[model samples]
Target: MSLPTSTASPTPTRSTPRPATPSHRSGYRTGLRWLLQTHGFMFLWALGMLVVLVAAATIIVSNVTTPAGSIVQHARQGLTWFPFSIAIVGITTYTNIHIGAGLTRRSLGWAALTAAVVMAVAYAALFTLALQLERAVYGWTGWAHGVDGAGGLFTSSGQVGLVVLDVGLLFLAGQLSGVLVGIVYYRAGGWWGTLALPLTAGPILLATPALSTAALGDLGLAPRVVLVLLVLGAMSLAAHRLILGVQVRKLAT
Candidate 1:
Protein backbone atom coordinates (compact mmCIF):
# COMPACT_ATOMS: atom_id res chain seq x y z
CA MET A 1 0.00 0.00 0.00
CA SER A 2 1.20 3.44 -0.92
CA LEU A 3 1.92 5.65 2.03
CA PRO A 4 -0.70 8.35 2.50
CA THR A 5 0.67 11.71 1.40
CA SER A 6 0.76 14.32 4.16
CA THR A 7 -1.58 17.15 3.21
CA ALA A 8 -1.30 19.44 6.30
CA SER A 9 -0.13 22.91 5.25
CA PRO A 10 2.94 24.37 6.98
CA THR A 11 2.03 26.75 9.82
CA PRO A 12 2.16 30.38 8.70
CA THR A 13 4.68 32.46 10.65
CA ARG A 14 3.87 36.12 11.46
CA SER A 15 6.80 38.40 12.14
CA THR A 16 5.99 40.85 14.92
CA PRO A 17 7.57 44.27 14.70
CA ARG A 18 9.09 45.65 17.89
CA PRO A 19 7.67 48.78 19.49
CA ALA A 20 9.71 51.92 18.96
CA THR A 21 11.73 53.19 21.86
CA PRO A 22 10.54 56.42 23.42
CA SER A 23 12.34 59.40 21.89
CA HIS A 24 13.79 62.13 24.08
CA ARG A 25 14.09 64.79 21.46
CA SER A 26 14.29 67.69 23.91
CA GLY A 27 12.26 69.75 21.45
CA TYR A 28 10.43 71.68 24.14
CA ARG A 29 13.60 72.46 26.03
CA THR A 30 15.36 73.51 22.86
CA GLY A 31 12.52 75.83 21.85
CA LEU A 32 12.47 77.45 25.27
CA ARG A 33 16.20 78.01 25.15
CA TRP A 34 15.91 79.60 21.74
CA LEU A 35 13.14 81.91 22.95
CA LEU A 36 15.13 83.01 25.96
CA GLN A 37 18.24 83.71 23.95
CA THR A 38 16.41 85.62 21.25
CA HIS A 39 14.39 87.62 23.72
CA GLY A 40 17.40 88.36 25.93
CA PHE A 41 19.51 89.62 23.06
CA MET A 42 16.75 91.83 21.67
CA PHE A 43 15.95 93.28 25.09
CA LEU A 44 19.55 94.09 25.95
CA TRP A 45 20.26 95.63 22.57
CA ALA A 46 17.14 97.79 22.67
CA LEU A 47 17.83 98.83 26.24
CA GLY A 48 21.35 99.89 25.33
CA MET A 49 20.01 101.99 22.50
CA LEU A 50 17.42 103.53 24.79
CA VAL A 51 20.05 104.39 27.39
CA VAL A 52 22.18 106.12 24.79
CA LEU A 53 19.25 108.07 23.44
CA VAL A 54 18.06 109.08 26.91
CA ALA A 55 21.54 110.17 27.97
CA ALA A 56 21.94 112.26 24.83
CA ALA A 57 18.54 113.86 25.32
CA THR A 58 19.29 114.62 28.94
CA ILE A 59 22.63 116.18 28.08
CA ILE A 60 21.12 118.33 25.36
CA VAL A 61 18.26 119.48 27.59
CA SER A 62 20.61 120.23 30.48
CA ASN A 63 22.81 122.43 28.29
CA VAL A 64 19.81 124.64 27.49
CA THR A 65 18.24 124.55 30.97
CA THR A 66 18.64 122.24 33.97
CA PRO A 67 15.89 119.68 33.39
CA ALA A 68 13.69 119.73 36.46
CA GLY A 69 13.35 115.96 36.94
CA SER A 70 14.74 112.54 36.10
CA ILE A 71 13.74 110.77 32.90
CA VAL A 72 13.78 107.24 34.36
CA GLN A 73 10.04 106.81 34.43
CA HIS A 74 9.65 108.07 30.88
CA ALA A 75 12.36 105.75 29.68
CA ARG A 76 10.77 102.70 31.32
CA GLN A 77 7.39 103.57 29.86
CA GLY A 78 8.84 103.83 26.38
CA LEU A 79 10.83 100.61 26.78
CA THR A 80 7.64 98.60 27.26
CA TRP A 81 6.93 98.82 23.52
CA PHE A 82 10.13 97.12 22.42
CA PRO A 83 9.53 93.67 23.88
CA PHE A 84 6.19 93.44 22.11
CA SER A 85 7.61 94.43 18.77
CA ILE A 86 10.51 92.03 19.14
CA ALA A 87 8.28 89.12 20.12
CA ILE A 88 5.99 89.70 17.16
CA VAL A 89 8.84 89.69 14.71
CA GLY A 90 10.44 86.65 16.29
CA ILE A 91 7.22 84.62 16.21
CA THR A 92 6.28 85.57 12.67
CA THR A 93 9.68 84.85 11.22
CA TYR A 94 10.73 81.80 13.21
CA THR A 95 7.60 79.65 13.45
CA ASN A 96 8.35 77.76 10.26
CA ILE A 97 11.97 77.10 11.14
CA HIS A 98 11.05 75.90 14.62
CA ILE A 99 8.29 73.56 13.41
CA GLY A 100 10.45 72.19 10.69
CA ALA A 101 13.07 71.33 13.25
CA GLY A 102 10.56 69.11 15.15
CA LEU A 103 9.05 71.54 17.64
CA THR A 104 5.31 71.46 18.22
CA ARG A 105 3.24 74.60 17.88
CA ARG A 106 1.96 74.14 21.40
CA SER A 107 5.47 73.98 22.73
CA LEU A 108 6.50 77.07 20.85
CA GLY A 109 3.48 79.01 22.13
CA TRP A 110 4.11 78.13 25.76
CA ALA A 111 7.80 78.87 25.36
CA ALA A 112 7.03 82.26 23.91
CA LEU A 113 4.69 82.98 26.82
CA THR A 114 7.22 81.91 29.43
CA ALA A 115 9.89 84.03 27.79
CA ALA A 116 7.53 87.00 27.74
CA VAL A 117 6.87 86.70 31.46
CA VAL A 118 10.56 86.39 32.23
CA MET A 119 11.38 89.31 29.99
CA ALA A 120 8.72 91.42 31.70
CA VAL A 121 9.96 90.63 35.18
CA ALA A 122 13.55 91.33 34.20
CA TYR A 123 12.63 94.63 32.61
CA ALA A 124 10.60 95.67 35.66
CA ALA A 125 13.47 94.93 38.01
CA LEU A 126 16.03 96.70 35.83
CA PHE A 127 13.78 99.70 35.40
CA THR A 128 13.26 99.98 39.15
CA LEU A 129 17.00 99.79 39.75
CA ALA A 130 17.59 102.43 37.10
CA LEU A 131 15.10 104.71 38.82
CA GLN A 132 16.86 104.19 42.12
CA LEU A 133 20.15 105.07 40.45
CA GLU A 134 18.55 108.18 39.00
CA ARG A 135 17.32 109.14 42.43
CA ALA A 136 20.82 108.81 43.79
CA VAL A 137 22.25 110.90 41.00
CA TYR A 138 19.59 113.53 41.62
CA GLY A 139 20.53 113.56 45.30
CA TRP A 140 24.19 114.03 44.48
CA THR A 141 23.41 116.90 42.10
CA GLY A 142 20.86 118.58 44.40
CA TRP A 143 18.26 118.17 41.69
CA ALA A 144 14.72 116.86 42.27
CA HIS A 145 13.91 113.40 40.88
CA GLY A 146 10.31 114.20 40.15
CA VAL A 147 9.79 112.72 36.68
CA ASP A 148 7.36 110.24 38.20
CA GLY A 149 4.92 112.66 36.62
CA ALA A 150 2.66 110.14 34.87
CA GLY A 151 1.31 109.49 38.37
CA GLY A 152 -0.04 105.97 38.11
CA LEU A 153 0.91 102.58 39.53
CA PHE A 154 4.44 102.90 38.14
CA THR A 155 4.96 106.46 39.29
CA SER A 156 3.98 105.89 42.92
CA SER A 157 6.54 106.80 45.59
CA GLY A 158 8.30 104.05 47.55
CA GLN A 159 6.05 101.40 46.03
CA VAL A 160 8.39 99.02 44.30
CA GLY A 161 5.85 96.21 44.33
CA LEU A 162 3.25 98.28 42.55
CA VAL A 163 5.77 99.50 40.04
CA VAL A 164 6.89 95.98 39.23
CA LEU A 165 3.33 94.80 38.91
CA ASP A 166 2.48 97.68 36.60
CA VAL A 167 5.52 97.19 34.43
CA GLY A 168 5.07 93.44 34.31
CA LEU A 169 1.45 93.73 33.26
CA LEU A 170 2.27 96.30 30.60
CA PHE A 171 4.99 94.16 29.11
CA LEU A 172 2.82 91.07 29.19
CA ALA A 173 0.06 92.90 27.39
CA GLY A 174 2.49 94.28 24.88
CA GLN A 175 3.96 90.88 24.15
CA LEU A 176 0.60 89.22 23.77
CA SER A 177 -0.74 91.99 21.54
CA GLY A 178 2.34 91.72 19.40
CA VAL A 179 1.81 88.00 18.99
CA LEU A 180 -1.80 88.56 18.11
CA VAL A 181 -0.94 91.08 15.42
CA GLY A 182 1.74 88.86 13.96
CA ILE A 183 -0.52 85.82 13.90
CA VAL A 184 -3.34 87.81 12.38
CA TYR A 185 -1.08 89.08 9.66
CA TYR A 186 0.30 85.64 8.99
CA ARG A 187 -3.11 83.99 8.79
CA ALA A 188 -5.14 86.76 7.20
CA GLY A 189 -2.48 88.49 5.14
CA GLY A 190 -2.07 92.25 4.74
CA TRP A 191 -5.41 93.86 4.09
CA TRP A 192 -7.24 91.73 6.62
CA GLY A 193 -4.56 92.34 9.20
CA THR A 194 -4.84 96.06 8.63
CA LEU A 195 -8.57 95.84 9.15
CA ALA A 196 -8.03 93.68 12.25
CA LEU A 197 -5.49 96.03 13.82
CA PRO A 198 -7.94 97.68 16.22
CA LEU A 199 -9.02 94.30 17.58
CA THR A 200 -5.49 92.99 17.96
CA ALA A 201 -4.29 96.20 19.65
CA GLY A 202 -7.35 96.60 21.85
CA PRO A 203 -5.65 95.35 24.99
CA ILE A 204 -2.72 97.72 24.63
CA LEU A 205 -5.05 100.63 24.04
CA LEU A 206 -7.24 99.67 26.99
CA ALA A 207 -4.24 99.47 29.30
CA THR A 208 -3.39 103.07 28.49
CA PRO A 209 -6.42 104.18 30.49
CA ALA A 210 -4.83 102.59 33.55
CA LEU A 211 -1.18 103.20 32.72
CA SER A 212 -1.30 106.97 32.41
CA THR A 213 -3.27 108.17 35.42
CA ALA A 214 -2.21 111.70 34.62
CA ALA A 215 -3.88 111.50 31.23
CA LEU A 216 -6.95 109.73 32.59
CA GLY A 217 -6.93 111.75 35.85
CA ASP A 218 -6.53 109.39 38.81
CA LEU A 219 -8.90 106.52 38.10
CA GLY A 220 -8.05 105.16 41.60
CA LEU A 221 -5.65 102.36 42.36
CA ALA A 222 -8.10 99.47 42.54
CA PRO A 223 -9.89 100.42 39.36
CA ARG A 224 -6.69 100.99 37.42
CA VAL A 225 -5.18 97.72 38.58
CA VAL A 226 -8.36 95.87 37.70
CA LEU A 227 -8.35 97.40 34.24
CA VAL A 228 -4.76 96.42 33.65
CA LEU A 229 -5.31 92.86 34.82
CA LEU A 230 -8.40 92.52 32.66
CA VAL A 231 -6.59 93.70 29.58
CA LEU A 232 -3.72 91.36 30.30
CA GLY A 233 -6.09 88.41 30.58
CA ALA A 234 -7.87 89.34 27.38
CA MET A 235 -4.67 89.67 25.45
CA SER A 236 -3.40 86.38 26.83
CA LEU A 237 -6.53 84.56 25.70
CA ALA A 238 -6.34 86.14 22.26
CA ALA A 239 -2.73 85.03 21.95
CA HIS A 240 -3.54 81.45 22.82
CA ARG A 241 -6.38 81.35 20.34
CA LEU A 242 -4.18 82.78 17.64
CA ILE A 243 -1.38 80.34 18.32
CA LEU A 244 -3.27 77.07 18.52
CA GLY A 245 -3.22 74.88 15.39
CA VAL A 246 -1.13 77.52 13.64
CA GLN A 247 -0.11 76.56 10.09
CA VAL A 248 3.43 77.41 9.10
CA ARG A 249 3.58 79.43 5.91
CA LYS A 250 6.28 78.94 3.30
CA LEU A 251 8.96 81.60 3.07
CA ALA A 252 10.10 82.99 -0.27
CA THR A 253 13.72 82.45 -1.14
Candidate 2:
Protein backbone atom coordinates (compact mmCIF):
# COMPACT_ATOMS: atom_id res chain seq x y z
CA MET A 1 0.00 0.00 0.00
CA SER A 2 1.24 3.48 -0.87
CA LEU A 3 2.67 5.29 2.23
CA PRO A 4 0.23 7.82 3.55
CA THR A 5 1.37 11.27 2.47
CA SER A 6 2.42 13.00 5.68
CA THR A 7 3.64 16.64 5.77
CA ALA A 8 6.82 17.18 7.85
CA SER A 9 7.25 20.43 9.78
CA PRO A 10 10.67 22.21 9.72
CA THR A 11 12.22 23.57 12.98
CA PRO A 12 13.52 27.12 13.13
CA THR A 13 17.17 27.78 14.09
CA ARG A 14 18.62 30.94 15.73
CA SER A 15 21.95 32.13 14.23
CA THR A 16 23.37 34.64 16.71
CA PRO A 17 27.16 34.85 16.82
CA ARG A 18 28.93 33.66 19.98
CA PRO A 19 30.28 36.28 22.41
CA ALA A 20 34.03 36.89 22.47
CA THR A 21 36.05 34.92 24.98
CA PRO A 22 37.89 36.66 27.85
CA SER A 23 41.18 35.90 26.13
CA HIS A 24 40.15 38.10 23.22
CA ARG A 25 40.26 41.28 25.29
CA SER A 26 43.43 43.38 25.24
CA GLY A 27 45.67 43.15 28.35
CA TYR A 28 47.38 45.89 30.40
CA ARG A 29 50.93 45.19 29.24
CA THR A 30 51.28 48.46 27.38
CA GLY A 31 50.04 50.68 30.23
CA LEU A 32 52.09 48.78 32.82
CA ARG A 33 55.30 49.04 30.79
CA TRP A 34 54.87 52.76 30.15
CA LEU A 35 54.15 53.34 33.83
CA LEU A 36 57.28 51.41 34.83
CA GLN A 37 59.55 53.39 32.52
CA THR A 38 57.95 56.78 33.24
CA HIS A 39 57.74 56.49 37.03
CA GLY A 40 61.26 55.03 37.37
CA PHE A 41 62.61 58.05 35.50
CA MET A 42 60.75 60.43 37.85
CA PHE A 43 61.98 58.97 41.16
CA LEU A 44 65.66 58.63 40.30
CA TRP A 45 65.80 62.00 38.57
CA ALA A 46 64.19 63.78 41.56
CA LEU A 47 66.54 62.13 44.06
CA GLY A 48 69.48 63.17 41.90
CA MET A 49 68.20 66.78 41.87
CA LEU A 50 67.91 66.74 45.67
CA VAL A 51 71.50 65.56 46.07
CA VAL A 52 72.71 68.28 43.75
CA LEU A 53 70.67 70.86 45.63
CA VAL A 54 72.22 69.84 48.96
CA ALA A 55 75.70 70.18 47.53
CA ALA A 56 74.93 73.63 46.16
CA ALA A 57 73.33 74.65 49.44
CA THR A 58 76.46 73.51 51.25
CA ILE A 59 78.64 75.70 49.01
CA ILE A 60 76.38 78.72 49.42
CA VAL A 61 76.24 78.31 53.22
CA SER A 62 80.05 78.43 53.24
CA ASN A 63 79.81 82.03 51.91
CA VAL A 64 80.62 81.24 48.29
CA THR A 65 78.54 83.33 45.90
CA THR A 66 76.20 80.96 44.10
CA PRO A 67 77.22 80.98 40.44
CA ALA A 68 75.82 83.94 38.49
CA GLY A 69 74.16 81.94 35.72
CA SER A 70 73.01 79.13 38.00
CA ILE A 71 69.26 79.73 37.82
CA VAL A 72 69.25 80.79 34.14
CA GLN A 73 71.25 77.72 33.19
CA HIS A 74 68.70 75.50 34.89
CA ALA A 75 65.87 77.29 33.15
CA ARG A 76 67.47 76.63 29.75
CA GLN A 77 67.72 72.97 30.60
CA GLY A 78 63.95 72.97 30.92
CA LEU A 79 63.59 73.87 27.23
CA THR A 80 65.04 70.54 26.20
CA TRP A 81 63.46 68.60 29.02
CA PHE A 82 59.86 69.84 29.16
CA PRO A 83 58.94 69.38 25.52
CA PHE A 84 60.72 66.05 25.28
CA SER A 85 58.85 64.75 28.31
CA ILE A 86 55.45 65.60 26.91
CA ALA A 87 56.42 64.01 23.60
CA ILE A 88 57.65 60.75 25.09
CA VAL A 89 54.74 60.29 27.45
CA GLY A 90 52.33 60.73 24.57
CA ILE A 91 54.39 58.90 21.93
CA THR A 92 55.23 55.95 24.14
CA THR A 93 51.65 55.36 25.17
CA TYR A 94 50.37 55.81 21.61
CA THR A 95 53.06 53.52 20.23
CA ASN A 96 51.78 50.53 22.15
CA ILE A 97 48.63 50.83 20.09
CA HIS A 98 50.39 51.68 16.81
CA ILE A 99 54.01 50.63 16.63
CA GLY A 100 54.87 53.28 14.05
CA ALA A 101 53.49 56.41 15.65
CA GLY A 102 56.41 58.77 15.28
CA LEU A 103 56.38 61.98 13.29
CA THR A 104 59.02 63.93 11.36
CA ARG A 105 61.33 66.26 13.25
CA ARG A 106 59.56 69.19 11.62
CA SER A 107 56.20 68.04 12.91
CA LEU A 108 57.72 67.31 16.27
CA GLY A 109 59.12 70.82 16.30
CA TRP A 110 55.57 72.13 16.19
CA ALA A 111 54.46 69.58 18.75
CA ALA A 112 57.30 70.69 21.00
CA LEU A 113 56.19 74.29 20.70
CA THR A 114 52.68 73.18 21.46
CA ALA A 115 53.91 71.51 24.62
CA ALA A 116 55.48 74.78 25.80
CA VAL A 117 52.23 76.61 25.18
CA VAL A 118 50.42 73.95 27.12
CA MET A 119 52.85 74.34 30.02
CA ALA A 120 52.16 78.05 30.25
CA VAL A 121 48.45 77.44 30.14
CA ALA A 122 48.74 74.83 32.85
CA TYR A 123 50.84 77.07 35.08
CA ALA A 124 48.46 79.97 34.68
CA ALA A 125 45.50 77.77 35.50
CA LEU A 126 47.14 76.18 38.50
CA PHE A 127 48.52 79.43 39.80
CA THR A 128 45.16 81.10 39.44
CA LEU A 129 43.46 78.23 41.20
CA ALA A 130 46.04 78.31 43.95
CA LEU A 131 45.50 82.02 44.36
CA GLN A 132 41.75 81.58 44.53
CA LEU A 133 42.16 78.94 47.16
CA GLU A 134 44.46 81.27 49.03
CA ARG A 135 41.85 84.05 48.92
CA ALA A 136 39.13 81.79 50.23
CA VAL A 137 41.32 80.63 53.07
CA TYR A 138 42.29 84.23 53.82
CA GLY A 139 38.69 85.32 53.80
CA TRP A 140 37.80 82.67 56.34
CA THR A 141 40.87 83.05 58.59
CA GLY A 142 41.48 86.80 58.21
CA TRP A 143 45.19 86.24 57.74
CA ALA A 144 47.04 88.04 54.95
CA HIS A 145 50.58 89.40 54.87
CA GLY A 146 53.47 90.69 52.68
CA VAL A 147 53.83 93.08 49.75
CA ASP A 148 54.23 91.97 46.12
CA GLY A 149 57.22 93.74 44.65
CA ALA A 150 57.56 94.64 40.99
CA GLY A 151 56.61 91.68 38.80
CA GLY A 152 54.51 90.25 41.60
CA LEU A 153 55.25 86.76 40.27
CA PHE A 154 57.96 86.28 42.90
CA THR A 155 55.78 87.15 45.87
CA SER A 156 54.74 85.34 49.08
CA SER A 157 52.51 83.46 51.51
CA GLY A 158 49.60 85.70 52.26
CA GLN A 159 48.05 82.26 52.39
CA VAL A 160 49.79 79.37 54.14
CA GLY A 161 47.88 76.73 52.17
CA LEU A 162 49.07 78.42 48.99
CA VAL A 163 52.60 78.48 50.29
CA VAL A 164 52.51 74.74 50.96
CA LEU A 165 50.75 73.94 47.69
CA ASP A 166 53.22 76.04 45.76
CA VAL A 167 56.09 74.05 47.20
CA GLY A 168 54.38 70.76 46.43
CA LEU A 169 53.68 71.80 42.85
CA LEU A 170 57.29 72.78 42.24
CA PHE A 171 58.56 69.53 43.73
CA LEU A 172 56.19 67.44 41.64
CA ALA A 173 57.03 69.34 38.46
CA GLY A 174 60.75 68.77 38.99
CA GLN A 175 60.16 65.07 39.48
CA LEU A 176 58.05 64.79 36.33
CA SER A 177 60.63 66.71 34.30
CA GLY A 178 63.35 64.33 35.42
CA VAL A 179 61.26 61.40 34.32
CA LEU A 180 60.70 62.86 30.86
CA VAL A 181 64.36 63.65 30.33
CA GLY A 182 65.32 60.12 31.25
CA ILE A 183 62.80 58.63 28.87
CA VAL A 184 64.09 60.77 26.00
CA TYR A 185 67.66 59.76 26.79
CA TYR A 186 66.69 56.16 26.37
CA ARG A 187 64.61 56.77 23.25
CA ALA A 188 67.26 58.94 21.59
CA GLY A 189 69.82 56.21 22.05
CA GLY A 190 68.59 53.03 23.65
CA TRP A 191 72.20 51.84 24.09
CA TRP A 192 72.76 53.93 27.22
CA GLY A 193 69.89 51.83 28.57
CA THR A 194 68.96 52.36 32.21
CA LEU A 195 71.62 54.99 32.87
CA ALA A 196 70.59 56.98 29.79
CA LEU A 197 67.46 58.58 31.21
CA PRO A 198 68.90 59.36 34.64
CA LEU A 199 72.11 60.99 33.48
CA THR A 200 70.31 62.92 30.80
CA ALA A 201 68.19 64.48 33.50
CA GLY A 202 70.99 64.92 36.06
CA PRO A 203 72.08 68.50 35.30
CA ILE A 204 70.54 71.62 36.89
CA LEU A 205 67.31 69.69 37.45
CA LEU A 206 68.42 68.50 40.88
CA ALA A 207 69.44 71.98 41.92
CA THR A 208 66.31 73.76 40.66
CA PRO A 209 64.93 74.93 44.01
CA ALA A 210 68.35 75.93 45.32
CA LEU A 211 68.97 78.00 42.22
CA SER A 212 65.65 79.77 42.74
CA THR A 213 66.29 80.31 46.42
CA ALA A 214 69.62 82.02 45.82
CA ALA A 215 68.33 84.11 42.94
CA LEU A 216 65.28 85.35 44.83
CA GLY A 217 67.26 85.90 48.01
CA ASP A 218 69.72 88.07 46.13
CA LEU A 219 66.77 90.33 45.28
CA GLY A 220 66.40 91.06 49.03
CA LEU A 221 63.05 89.35 49.22
CA ALA A 222 61.61 87.94 52.44
CA PRO A 223 62.17 84.26 53.23
CA ARG A 224 58.53 83.29 52.81
CA VAL A 225 58.26 85.17 49.53
CA VAL A 226 61.53 83.76 48.32
CA LEU A 227 60.36 80.29 49.21
CA VAL A 228 57.24 80.67 47.12
CA LEU A 229 59.18 82.10 44.18
CA LEU A 230 61.76 79.36 44.37
CA VAL A 231 59.11 76.73 44.27
CA LEU A 232 57.23 78.43 41.46
CA GLY A 233 60.35 78.96 39.39
CA ALA A 234 61.36 75.34 39.81
CA MET A 235 57.96 74.30 38.58
CA SER A 236 58.32 76.60 35.56
CA LEU A 237 61.68 75.04 34.78
CA ALA A 238 60.26 71.56 35.05
CA ALA A 239 57.46 72.50 32.70
CA HIS A 240 59.91 73.76 30.07
CA ARG A 241 61.98 70.60 30.37
CA LEU A 242 58.95 68.42 29.89
CA ILE A 243 58.02 70.35 26.77
CA LEU A 244 61.45 69.80 25.24
CA GLY A 245 61.25 66.18 26.22
CA VAL A 246 57.98 65.81 24.36
CA GLN A 247 59.65 67.22 21.26
CA VAL A 248 62.61 64.87 21.46
CA ARG A 249 60.59 61.69 21.90
CA LYS A 250 58.06 62.73 19.29
CA LEU A 251 60.88 63.08 16.78
CA ALA A 252 62.59 59.83 17.69
CA THR A 253 61.18 57.25 15.30
By lDDT, the best candidate is: 1
Question: Tens digits of per-residue lDDT for model 2 on 160-233?
Answer: 45433433344344434443454454355466634554543443344344334334455433554455456445
lDDT of 1 by residue, 1-253 (tens): 1111221221122232432531222433455567677888987887787678767876887789877777777766576788778877877776777788866676566656656667788787777777777677767877667756464466543567777777777777787788888878877788998899899867777786577767667568788788788777767666766776788776767
Residue-level error in angstroms, candidate 1, position 98:
1.8
> TM-score, each model?
0.82, 0.37
The TM-score obtained by model 2 is: 0.37
What's the lDDT of the predicted structure labeled candidate 2?
A: 0.38
Assess each prediction's global lDDT (C-alpha) against the native. 0.69, 0.38
Residue 203 of model 2, lDDT score: 34
What does candidate 1 score on TM? 0.82
